[model samples]
Target: MDRQLKPNPPKRKTSMLSYWTLRYFLILCIGFTLIAAGALYWIRSTSIEKSMKTAELLGLEIAEKVTGPGNRLLIPPDIDMLVDKRIKLFNTDNYFCIMVLDNNHHLMYSRPKMTQDDVRYHLSDDLNAPRNKNYAGVTVNITDSNETLGKVWVMQSKKSLTFSTETFVIVVLLLAALILCGWFTIYWLSRKLSKPIRQVAHAAEQIRIGNYEVNLDIDTKEQEMNELVSSFRDMSIRLKQLEEWRALSLAGVTHELKTPVTSIKGLVMAVRDDIVSPQEGKEFLDIALKESQRMERMVADLLDYNAMSAGSVAVRHERIDLHLLVREIIYQWRITCEDKMPEIELEASTGTQYAIGDALRVQQIIVNLLNNGLQAMSDEQTPAFRIRLQAEGEHLSIDVRDYGTGIAPEDQPKIFERFYRGELKKRRTRGLGLGLTYSRLLAEAQDGELFLASSSPEGSIFTLRLPLWTPPDQHKREQTYRSPVNA
Candidate 1:
């Protein structure tokens, strides 16, 4: 069946405005709140300092004007008049009370209608102390030519400071409210902007799980998000196309299977009918067997690649001695290649060389490398292959080297790609081209890595590194063995 090809779709870009709006609005709100708080504090502090200074100046002025021989130790009538004028001024200016006291702690003068006796007593006691201190009352002592006449005390109401503090608190609360409002605004805006993205993510997830019919339901009024949804929808369509293509490829591979089986069946029937010589029939049977093996290997590799791609491959993990594992793999490969007469080499350090890994998978990786090395040198006059193992720190390294015709620079990067055949167009051996890819995948699944060290005229070196393991008991045994015998 003919399949339809889908066109590539453009990617959707996120809106720059959304980010800018949130960032700038939050910054402005914070800036305004901080500036407002700082301004209010400065105003309150300046106003309080000015009020205290004004009260001090007035007290000094009254003290200077009221001091005399009669005023020195006595209450003068002019002093009373001056105190009354100051009291009227203070009251009009929102001050609580004003009082003038003699050196004898006598309230010589006070504000009119001052029924609160506690105010007067507090002032008297505050001024009579040896050291003048301003508390609730900002006291200023009156002295004439170094003679203590009395003290002019300006008592500011606790209400004024209370009012200022309360005002500051209210301003702070307003700032907090503003911050809260900004947070709400940002949250609401982010949610609105993210809604379409969430939908697109859901659709993509559906597609990921093999749902090719998933479609995005998004509002086109939001231009940017609409574009994103459209792009995702297009991606879904392309994935569907690829899935169909894969089905077709599998069908093609299956159809191809029939030709070889038919050829083998025809050859077997011809031999039964005695249409060819026995030797010729034997050759045909050998070819048929080789072709069958090729088909089996191809199908097996395809299944492995599919399993790996689907993330369904299970790796059996356990603590394995690297030295023993490498030795076993080398021995098996040497036996398999006994007729080829390829040279094999091993190098390792003296230690436990233990690693947490899957022994079978490690053996598979070694086998794949050995097979590749052998194939690369099949045409050479004297094919030689070497396998080396070395321990370094917490890692064990395996190097597989071959003295064959090296891979071309252009083919080096794609050598590990599935189904990729290098510069040698006519394959020397029947392979599904998944050896290196499967080996790399198996290495990665074990928390190890595989990479081509170098490819030159001297051939290629593929290195494999797996993490080493050290048990606590082995460490204790080594420590005990190192202890002095005399002790």
Candidate 2:
């Protein structure tokens, strides 16, 4: 029976693309944010530092111009006049307040109309904020040669070297918008890429439920994904075919095995019931023996077919002479069926037509073909069965031709299918329909092919082609390691 056993669906797993994409997006956002913030802070601090240095240089130059002589502090004739002139000359945009101090650090002159806040801040007992923020200032000493006259103090207001609140707010909002856009873009792309993969996974689930007809007609941009889908489709097709073959095999085995056993039982029952006389005992016993032999042959054929299907058929490939093999098979067949056998003839293309194959398997294939040929003919009244061997190009061909009622056109195509029977009159004999199938399998497993070459009312010819064997030189040992079948 062809059983449709559906397996339970597997537990759903978490989506890897969703998790990893989000995690990576977060990491990128954090990394880029830190970089942007640090760069901004550096620019602000560098600008503030440069401003403080410029203010100190300008103050020193002003103090030099007002010096009377030597290094002694000299007050300008117009105190406010000198301060205002110097402040206007040196750009005061970067400085909140600029003041001159005497040698003792006491304030002497001021510029920019110093406010209460500025005065308190410059003269405070302790600076309250981080210098890099806004409370940055610079102080330079007024000197001439080896003497200090006074000091110049430049005050940096809280608004001097940093962006205003409005500008800062706009920058932060832009950065947030960019981060959101980037995160969403990454998420969208990940979902788009994983969509096809998800479809393939769904198809796999259906296959697990014994649905070989699941449609996988999908298009993908990736070459690897396309190949994977194609391979899956082929696997489904092969599996369906194998299931059909298995079901047919089961039915055929049951019928072949039961027929012989039933015949033996019926014959024994006839004797036990005294339905036959004692004089006919030998004939009945002979019939029973033939039935047992038939059963034994059927069992052997089934095992052989199983071995071939399982890929466990051992083949020892070697150089063999096809002419010799054909002659041996024909002789054996004649000897076995001498009581009621047709005339058999062998025609060889040459004295030695060599081929590469397993000798035992090759012999089995030839025997099977011979048996089929012999079975096709009802009696010796028909023409002789001919075994022809020839070397064609790079291959050797052996044709087993029987002169009898040829196979019908409709039945020819399926004759090599396992357990497929046709031609009711020809298949009237009680036997499993595995002989031709096994013969073809054996031939293929040996790097050879067995096919129906031609068929007509006169006869049918089954041809086998194998690679011609040519003994390799010692240097070419690496090229050939007793290769297996092309199949």
Candidate 3:
């Protein structure tokens, strides 16, 4: 069946700088505008209230002055003479007009006597009359010994009691200036922050497309941004290293598998075709068996490495005596490599050292390291392998030393990389180049580390470190609480 390739959807361009800048500008403008408007309204209301209160106080004083000697409300003809002199002597600029109206809605006395049209326009018989836009009015009653006489009306001009249009315009302009400054600050900050983030995202895209050469040379004053760029650069370098190793592994696998299979095939065909005598045929069969063993070993190494990489191998932790484990593994190796065998030595502390790890896995790691050491020593050299065990406060260190030509300085750094074979010219063995890789992975999975401790023209020392195990009685408590049933 054919598979359909779907095109990726186009990405929409977004400007975080523009988005946050506009939001900040609008919020500041609205907030400040409301505050300014509220302040203006309060000032106007206070001024109007103060003016009305002053008008009332003035009316009371005028009423006392117009009171006659007998405490009577003098009629309009008598009031006319007393009111003009009293108003002139105690007048304020707060109110514009004052008038006295009797209970019958007749205008009895007024400052600057009004025409008929003016009286009709200004007069109101109802107590709850709505105020006009041009004036605010207050009414006070005149009383003589608790008897109603007349009503006094005081009107103040709106022009004096409220703010002008010019004043409001000035306040709005000032608020706009502040809002503009805020917008500019927001725009500057957004640009400064988002530019580096955009560059990081762009570099990530380049990496996703398999371009490992992308450089994130961002110069930011922010510490967090600097750290982010540094981490990305490290990731890019690691990916490049893995890419190179993958290519080398592919080539090595083909070569390792092909050599053994070709030898087995050629020998079998030779024996079947009667190219060799009966005795020679038996010898060829023996060589073929060895070649088959080589092939099996290569396939097994590949399977082990794959299983580790897939995380399918579970580690069962247990207490094992480190020195005895190494000695047992060495004994097995001695028997397997009896032909042109390497002499294995175990130098360990007299005391038994216990470690926490899977015993089988730890044995696997040691066997692989020992095999690599054996392979390093050619038939011409006096083969010697040493396993040294030591305990250093809370941890155990195992050193596997081989008496062979040491690894070159250039190859030491990548010695543990998958399928990496150093000193290829000296390697006359037939096997996949994943021994060190598998050993390193196995060691790490068991909460241990494998590293090259030292190397020289004589030999190289590889060290493995694992946590020292404590007896159950000496172990620390993990929990302090228990269930009721357990208790």
Give the top-scoring candidate (lDDT).
3
Q: Pairs clashing in candidate 1? A: none
lDDT of 2 at 48: 69
How high is each candidate's TM-score?
Answer: 0.47, 0.72, 0.75
Q: After superposition, how far is residue 432 of candidate 2 from its true place, in Å?
A: 3.5
TM-score of 2: 0.72
lDDT tens per residue, model 2, 291-316: 99999998898899989989998876
**Poorest 10 consecutive residues by lDDT, candidate 1:** 478-487
Off by over 4 Å in 2: 1-12, 49-97, 109-134, 139-151, 157-175, 275-287, 308-314, 317-319, 356-358, 377-383, 404-417, 422-427, 444-447, 454-459, 467-487
Candidate maximizing TM-score: 3
Q: Tens-digit lDDT track for model 3 on 1-487?
A: 8989899999986688877888888899889889888988897998788778877876776565555556555544555555555546544443467776666556765666775456567754354342465788777888788876667777767676766567778888888888888888889989999998888888889889988787787889999988988988898898887887787778888988888789999999999999999999999999999999889988999998999999998986667778777877787778888886778878997967888777787778877877777777666897798888998888899999998777889999988877778755226676667888898898899888899999887988999888888766646522221211233
Better of 2 and 3 by TM-score: 3
Q: lDDT for every model?
A: 0.72, 0.74, 0.77
Displacement of residue 378 (Cα, Å) in model 3 is 4.3
Q: What is the lDDT of residue 370 in candidate 2?
A: 70
